[model samples]
Target: MTKKIYWAAVIYTILGLLGGLYYRELTKAKNFTGETQLAILHTHLLALGTLVFLIVLVLEKVFALSETKSFKPFFWSYHAGMVITVGGMAVHGTLTVLGKESGGAIAGIAGLGHIILTVAFVLLFAGLYARISDKQPVKAA
Candidate 1:
């Protein structure tokens, strides 16, 4: 489980790097213009997704998070949120760059993604709280 979390963080980091390179290339080509929606996507993928996952990995050992029933749900929900949010950002950014305005649907999808992210965080916190509250002191060998 810990390995899975680490791998997920690594994947997000690689993707974030790719997004940065792509954004730099687009800027060099004068295609990026002033629309920073994709830029936000790039940063958030690294900052929120990658960084947060890494933090959770560190927390897992301290909290024994694997023992919690909510661990699986938290993991899946958070990753799904990242995918939906980043996917929305990509679509919305592409449309903006193409000079096409994002309609209500696009905005709504993105909004839903954020909502999922919020719920996922809530679940994660609850799981952590449960583990911490129930934790027992370790005995010396």
Candidate 2:
């Protein structure tokens, strides 16, 4: 699980760097000087994907979090949410750069991603709390 989480972080870091490169090159090609969602995709992937996975890796070391019941659900949910969120942003940004108007559906889909992430966070905390509370206290003889 630690290796898996670490690999996830590495993958996300590479993706984030690619995203940034895409944004720069695309904007340059389009001569787009204004703001676009592409600008944030890089940061979002880095922060939410890479950094969050690293934190989880540490937590797993401390708590053996992967053994918890909710860990699997949280992991899947987090990845699903991240993919949906990043996909939406990429599409929306591309449309914006191309001077195309997008409807509310895209925004709603991206919001759904956020909602999933929120639920995943709750699951992680619940698991962490369970781990902490299950620990027996040291005796003071």
Candidate 3:
């Protein structure tokens, strides 16, 4: 799971860099809206894709998943959400580049995916809080 998160982070970072470079070139060509969408793409990749994935990865290591089974579901949920969210952003971003405002199948799916991603973030937060706040009886030495 840690490996998966790291790989996702690396991939997302690379894509974000590419998007940035593309935005730079577009800006040089005076393509304003293209630059704006590319900026959004960069943020989406870095924040939702890289940052959230890293947080989950560190939490997995810190929490010791081998000792806890329940966390698996939350971790999977967050990861899945990030995947779908990033995938949607990629499709929608590309479409936006083509001068399409909205009203397409991919656009609809992308919008739904963003909502799922937000829900996933909330679930992850709840799971972490629950895990940390649970009390375990202590044995006195």
After superposition on all C-alphas, the RMSD of every candidate to the true structure, in Å, is 2.4, 3.5, 4.2
Q: What do the candidate models score in CA lDDT, each in turn? A: 0.81, 0.90, 0.63
Structure candidate 2, residue pairs in collision:
none
lDDT of 1 by residue, 87-124 (tens): 88888877776668888898788888899899989888
Candidate 3: segments with Cα more than 4 A from true spot: 26-35, 65-72, 104-106, 135-141
lDDT of 1: 0.81
Query: Which residue segments of model 2 deviate by more than 4 Å?
Result: 135-141
The TM-score of predicted model 3 comes to 0.67
lDDT of 2 by residue, 39-66 (tens): 9999999999999999999998888888
**Of candidates 3 and 2, the better by lDDT:** 2
Alpha-carbon TM-score of each model against the true structure: 0.89, 0.93, 0.67
Q: What is the TM-score of candidate 2?
A: 0.93
* Model 3 lDDT per residue over 3-99, tens place: 8767878877887787677666655565655433455777777777778677777876775432344455655665666566666666665556656
Q: Model 3 residue 116 lDDT?
A: 68
Cα deviation of 135, candidate 1, in Å: 6.6
The clash tally of candidate 2 reads 0
Query: Candidate 1 versus the native: TM-score?
Result: 0.89
